[model samples]
Target chain A: MSAADTILFVAAWLGLALLVAAFLLTVWRVVRGPTLPDRVVALDMLVGIVIGFIALIAIRTGFTLYIDIAIALGLVGFLATVAFARFILASKGRQGAGVYSAGAPLQDTAPAPDATHVAARGARGKSAAKSAKVAARTSGKTSAKKSPKSLPASPAVAELASVPAASPAIAPGKAAEEKPSAKSIGKPANKSASKTVSKSTSKTRSKSAEKTAGKAVTKPGKPAKGE
Target chain B: MDVVFAIFTAILILGGAAFALVAAIGLNRFPDVYSRMHAASKAGTVGSGLLLLAVGVHSGELSVLARALAGFFFFVLTAPVSAHLLAIAALKAGYSMSDKTVTNEME
Candidate 1:
């Protein structure tokens, strides 16, 4: 082979090796992450590494389509990160008790809203508590009153209320009540809440729940009649 | 001209690969998520940008160059934003930084 061809060949092999190593490191982070958000962040980095690999492949093979794939991967990766962040935020206390704490037995009651509220408030002070409370108020109204400031803790209460039960419709009403609060929280919160609302509403399959979720999603940033 | 271009491409690709390898090593060795993120975002973006530039140079086509440029810019823009968001989420979620990390910024 010519010198140029030889150089190209060597470069391709080197690039592949580097990318593979990077991928492995990212996977290690995913496996070793102490917290859920750490895992999410690692997963996001993995997506980026994969995009880099795709770009390298495109370079070696002269396929432009792979570049387009890299772009799509970036966009989708961003969306996934946002979704995961929202999930982490919404499901605050539940995850801390079940996943992060080492050797702790998973208790059904472990993710209590009060625990999460205290944790959120302790960790981030008033701002986080305010955000968490806003999130809670958007998810349900009954729990919203217990601690107007304890937003992060409200998810456990909401989840408990949402357990597939005879009164599935009741949970939706609570969720619907918080729709206006979601709109006020801004776009990311609105999108994440709508996504969660849709999922819960679909699972319950209550017509009123579906209607409420639909209306909340459509008229985002606008307070509905339920108030 | 061809020989010069080939030499430049080779150098760029090799250097980019080396940077990527270093980044991986750092990511694995860092004690905390914040530090790991720092290593990954900075080195990874630079490595990928260099590799894309190499590709653009090797192809010598305007379309390929343009695509590479776009990819480079996209990486530059997105990598920092993701890193920042991840850091914020981790902090909000109460993931403490490593004890060895001496910084008063977050406090």
Candidate 2:
């Protein structure tokens, strides 16, 4: 082989090794990433690594067409990242016991089972994330109360709304009075209430029960009319 | 002439690969998504762009080099825009910063 051929060959092999290393590292991040954005970032890096692979292959094979493929992949990757960002934005209000909820924090919001999973995860430093966590806590604190009035646009919040309304501890006499109104909320409301019941049963059973009960008896009697 | 082109392509390939490796290391080690984006968008783009140039140079044809250069520039332009949008979405969605974070002017 010519001197130029030898040098090019060596560089291509070395570059391939580096690119492969990068691919594995990025994949590890994707697997271990705690939040949606982390995974998105990793996936974006993965795309870049693949583009590198394409370049290496193009150089090794002497086919310039592969360059076109790399460009197409870049376009697609950018679009995918944008779409994922939009998805993250849309999922903002889905806070109750959701594993994917961004800014849920490692210590407080995430339950014990997912603790290890979330512990090592990092969100970019911003007060906005802190504010989100605070907002979630505050919302969750009043979720039981707000769900009734708002009827909670999402079923997850609706489940939270039903927690207290479904409790038997509420005076049967009052519940009887509210039963007719509760029935009007219909099957979807009942389904969500059952979900909260099951969820609460697994977690802080007595507290969520009583907390909702104390609040449910008041004005919530109308909106939280549980099935 | 062939030797000159080969030497240049080898250098581009080596530099590009090194940058890509650095980006991967940063991505794995960075404390948060935004920092990781910093690594991926800037270093990763340069790495990939360099590799694209390598392909263009290896072909030793002006037309092929032009196509590779165009792709390289495209990477340079789009990476930042996508990263910015993603960062905003993450912030707006309330993705928290790491505990080690010392300052947040945007807060």
Candidate 3:
């Protein structure tokens, strides 16, 4: 073997070891990460390193299979990243609870998915990740981040809305004629009476519940339509 | 020339192995997540480079050496990029880095 060849081979070997070390570090972070996105990101890094290793070792073994492995990994990894980003977006309380009337859109008054909202969501991920870490550290604050997703359904709110504070929302003429009794008292309009629910009340906002809320915000034209 | 080549490969492989072993140990030994990352990225980079180089020397064929060199270069470029991205992720995820570490003073 030539002196230069020896040097180059040595170089390749050292690179392999370093990449392994980096992979191990990434693995540690993946397991230790407090939130879903962090683990996802770490997984991405680990996959990238795997591709790099296959390519390096292929050079030594004189086989084409390794490079093929690298190519396959690249394609699969891209798909995984996109899917993860969507998952993260879907988890945030996008809308309110319950199914919308067929014509109603989400966030009636809130502006469309403009560049600004997109940027804000991106920014929100960063802060949310920070919050997740904080949540992990404190453990006690876990539920605080979960309450908004669990807000009462719009249908429930609407039922509460139509009812008067003291009685059910019956036709006004008939409701007046009926004498009130303890057994047949009117349904109280508790919906409007207590519009603001404490966000701190619920914290375990699972994936499905957030989706339900996101779908429930169906005010057609109002920007902040009860989403 | 032949004797020198053999000795060089021996040293290269041995050093590369030693670093790999240390990084493995560090993963278990380090108390915190950030310190473990440091041990892995820095030591792992050097160790892998040497191991690949050793392979190139052992293979001795022209085509093989050329390919090994490409891998070597790729490793050199990507190691630090991955490390930096990992660090960004670590910070963004909020695993507290060494408080005294000045690398991210701006943050």
Q: Which ten residues in a row have the lowest lDDT in candidate 1 chain A?
A: A100-109
Which segments of candidate 2 are over 4 A away from where they belong?
A95-227
How many clashing residue pairs, candidate 3?
39
Q: Find the candidate with the highest lDDT and give its number.
A: 2
What interface RMSD does candidate 2 have? 5.8
Candidate 2 vs candidate 3: the lDDT winner is 2
Interface RMSD of each: 6.1, 5.8, 10.0
- A102-199: candidate 3 lDDT, tens digit per residue: 11121221223321222222223444333222222121112222333212222333443343232212232321222122122212212222211111
Best candidate (score: TM-score): 2
Tens digit per residue, CA lDDT, model 1, A1-227: 87877777787787788778878877876776655666776777677667667767876897866777777787798778777777766653233322111111111212335433433343244544544533342334443565555545556545644443422222434333453343232112122233453333322223223333233233322222333
Weakest ten-residue segment in model 2 chain A by summed lDDT: A113-122
Residue A91, model 2: lDDT of: 54
- List runs of model 1 lying over 4 Å from the truth: A96-227, B105-107
How do the candidates rank by DockQ, highest first? 1, 2, 3
TM-score of each: 0.59, 0.62, 0.41
Return the lDDT, model 2, position B1: 86
lDDT of 1: 0.59
The 10-residue segment of model 3 chain A with minimum total lDDT is: A196-205
